[model samples]
Target: MTNETMMQYFEWYLPDDGKHWQHLAEDAEHLKAIGITKVWLPPAFKGTSSNDVGYGVYDLFDLGEFEQNGTVRTKYGTKADYLRAIASLKEKDIVPISDIVLNHKANADAKERFAVVKVKPDNRSETISEPYEIEAWTQFNFPGRQDKYSDFKWHWYHFTGVDYDALHDETGIYMILGDNKGWADSENIDQELGNYDYLMYDDIDFRHPEVQEHLKYWADWFLKTSGVGGFRLDAVKHIDKVFMKDFIRYVRENLKEDLYVFGEYWKDSNSDIVQYLEATDLQFDLIDVMLHMNFFEAGEKGSDFDLSTILEDSLMKSHPDFTVTFVDNHDSQRGQALESTVAEWFKPLAYGLILLRQEGTPCIFFGDYYGISGEFAQTGFQDILDKLLYIRKYHVYGPQEDYFDHPDCIGWTCLGDEKHPDGLAVVMTNGEASSKRLNMGELNRNKVFVDYLNNCPQEVVLDEAGWGEFPVQAASISAWVNKETHLSS
Candidate 1:
């Protein structure tokens, strides 16, 4: 079976002209041609505004179908366009993963008087102010939607917290005071900042039975309406882990049992991630933020960084089966709130590490593949990524061998299975130009191997015992394949 690769199809700075969905529909064939088996689309629902990047989710039911957010079309496109894009992806056998932001709701339609207690930003568990009435923007009527799909009007009672006090003209973390209203169980949520249940805007209260049922209903409706094969759950660390696991189970049981679900835990420690996995019963995969941090540090530190230890203390090492490895993401891209972009010079090495490995399911960032726009514009690695992606789909296979003896230079090889005979060798260095004499297995003995990346011009003829020294450029990566395949391509 061919390897599965996912591509995050949008950047932080995609043009707000509302044509992204159309572009996706047009590019579905190209994406499949490039070996992308899945596409994680940006939030398809209506947001705070048409220009909102879908994270500021206003109405879950109004997926660019209503005019409540000053426009009928979202930053991507209209409801029709969004559906068409999903169809295109499905037609190409590509799984369309929808970004689901359920942690909070933004841009409420009206203000509702509610009693709340102001809490310290650093420590949400401690209330610094007395319970007082504040007119909070927690009423979401979604008038434009007019309860078309399901009349689920939200009020302040349904939420756990609100950030802005409209009547007092104040903005802070205000925990709503009501029956069963508070942050999610601390034991079930991240302990960061005492409790991290309230991320931003009006935090959703999953503890409420109505809220849980409503969201489950929404999930079913969303799957039916959007035709998405998978879900990229956003801000899961702040939500209740028990609820997340249950919600996924509910969706899969009622809808599709093979539904692909992954959450953006955004934690860097493998221990913290493991805790979440255990809490959620390992129902979904998590993006390897720890691995991304390693790439970021390696990119920033250059030669001083130890290349061999890149996978150390990462989810890839501890829980590779449930890890979605990526070098950079929308949050880690340039200028985003969680910005920690891997350096451009080091991307070749990072891409090689993630895409060529047999460990984790790799995701290619849109900003890295198609380039980022706006003030911090940067060139993309389209050419190199295309080469690496092709090699991953058709070449990478069989028994893997790791050559991480050196701190700055590391190499690995996939000895090739019966189906893919002329397997591949990969060598990379963070320091000077070098060669690593790696054994390519007896099956590949006496074959002439060439750098598929073409970064190095030399070719190596494997000896009778299948040992050949692979040459790589300084601070670069070379994906070596059989000479015959490289020339044919």
Candidate 2:
């Protein structure tokens, strides 16, 4: 399916400590007015404690029912309220997708105990059965380091100021600690790793059969009960590839719907990304890393990266028909935040490429449309969501097999139909204005077209020489349709 044809969803997080069903209901209406077809809500499941960001899992079945203000009456309301929110979104023709965290459980009072080393092992001494150490990103971390926080208290687990040794299970699988060493960077470890945050909690052994069963149970329950259209798999890179393969197959067998599954594989290289997609029958159908890199290069250094060509190449060469494309996501936008803000100008180009391209499913970032300003401004930027949605719904065509490229000049065109010699063509340019003339020997008397971004309609009349000039602007996008092929809708 083309990016324009599929339902575009926004990633939304409801504060665990704030609002109620009424507020969520109101928010659903706001999303509808802006043409969002779906809202990706964070995990509604009950956690070990009131750590506002809901990833710290305690009870998978609780659904936020047994906490302080979680009486089905206070903020975030009840399970019924959650259902109401889902129904409300459906009423507006929008689907509600719940964000699920299946990688690890909360460090605080873990329900399942894997194993803990009484005597620290050598070589892999930093390994722990559970992720007790708090990193800077978690809520329990000190003021500066928010990601790290211990999942449990001191008595239940071992607390060592130094990094915990990596552990090897009896089955010979390596399980790394959840401390700073467990993260991707050493700098993140130095700044956030601390004494009180040393305790490690459970990290599931995916090699075990029981663990697979546990995951399947929740997957079945969620699909049957919550009625979500798809899942945004969190921390997919951390889990074993075999586990993901089986897990995706199990979910597909049970749900039997056109379910979409994407992952948070944070990398830019197409070579690295193609492996993950090949591993599963349903690996992350879409990824956001490449676009995030492109956005960073475009916004930060004002680099002339041809986003359209890059997307086309990624889709055509690597993983076709199963890629998710997006400009910005929750994590990256929050960190390197753009200031001048060309969201409105950028969306038309981004969507034009995503929706018209034939290679992958296109994903529209939430904040890009909603205009999240203020302190959230740096973290959440959705300023041009409406305009993008408008163009996506009206102007762009669905995905097709034939895609034409002008990579040298950082431009490409997607043709919806080619056989009839009459089709909708979307043209995009990056920071360069150039013109191209097509040789249409028998195709004469064609109507000259201008894209939605163009203010005035500029018509090109074909002379007896059978040549016409197509002008594209710098750092902008445009789309054209042969007048004969215009859709009535």
Candidate 3:
């Protein structure tokens, strides 16, 4: 919790003209001034093509350094520009987080014929078609890279599965069981579609010792080459939990830096999240999708929503230390698959909870802070977020008190402490205007409190017993801090 906030600095619809890294470098100081402590950048390695979003990981060793995959630069920028952006952010006391996609590999150097069988997508155990020989894209020699980093030449035996077969011009999940080896069932992959480990491209098998060694080597190379402070791991649920745990440990202990690591496990069930955390032994932080869904539902339901249940079934409530909460992400912003964007009116309230509360690290989406263009039109909430982050940096602290007894309006108080005298009081409503009596400590008896949100201009003064009347407008949020703080003075 060294810093108060993290920003997801890119949207899905952003054009891939290869200038985002330079833009990030230019906005380094501006981001710091706006109270952003860390930024989660998109994947920066060379993808299947020049215009690819860097997720179709072809060569982990080539960070836009060598000419490969039909280009010398990724969709973000060249290797030099990416490194400079990271340096600029470090200079401003901001950490740059890189997205690590290690579940599969694409854009193979060549195709190889292998014996395979087709299985029912719903029940992978039941074979839908008999065994046949098909040419799969399962070779990656990296001739362009020329063994400058590592000489790990990949062939059909390196991968356990591939989605496309070039020989028959057919697309299906074919298990690459060579020399009596099968997909890693011990990884305990998703049971929904049977074997969820094979997501896309040539799925890497963690069971293979060579595969694990190659990934570990790449991890070290990526961390050293990029000089990033942390990683946002992609598709953790689809990979082996044991391997992820080892990789995370290797990153922290091997680098000898106090780095942070977060994973994207997009499940709406709190129980599912809890299960995943247990499997990984809490090695990485998770983006609480269940909590985000709660916010979205609350916003959509409006007055009819139960404000008391806003924090219910949320990882922030049960596991605060490893919960990385977010209001919306690239998938939910516009036309993606999980497009359940929270209503605009409730963004302030949603942000106030994560930023002001005593639990979870909050992430502000790029679309919300800077506004998305071309279809998803928004003026952005930069001004509101600026004020909230200022409060978060200085005034929001100490033990918390919750009054989630109301269905439409609820509030919480953070008792002022010696470190930060006269802490904070927060109130928000999903329905009608309401009031509450929160007892600030007896030491705060004569202190006056003012709403920094400004919409609720009425100032409140605590009585001799330390209780004050707090008012909140309908469908809005009001955050009150001691008048003695910097803003009040």
How much lDDT does each candidate structure score? 0.92, 0.49, 0.84
* Model 1 lDDT tens row, 1-489: 889899999988898999999999999999999999999999988898888999999989987888887999999999999999999999999999999999999999898998999999999999999999999888888888888999988999889898888898988999999887888888999999999999998899999998999998898888889889999999999999989999999988998889998889988678999889888989999999999999999999999998889999888889989989999988988788999999999998999999999987999999899998789798989999999999999888998899998997899999888898888899999999998989998877899999999899988999998999999999999999999987887
TM-score of each: 0.99, 0.69, 0.95
Q: Write the per-residue lDDT of candidate 2 for residues 255-357, one digit (tens) a residue.
A: 6456666676654566556666665654557564665455545544332554434553353346656766666655545433332233445555656556555
Number of the top-ranking candidate, with lDDT as the measure = 1
Stretch of 10 with least lDDT, candidate 3? 180-189
Error of 3 at 335 (Å): 1.1
Measured on C-alpha atoms, candidate 2 has an lDDT of 0.49
Model 2 per-residue lDDT at 450:
46
Error of 2 at 460 (Å): 3.9
Candidate that scores best on TM-score: 1
Which of the predicted structures, 2 or 3, would earn the higher lDDT when compared with the native? 3
Q: Pairing residues by index, what is the TM-score of model 2?
A: 0.69
Candidate 2 lDDT at 222 equals 68
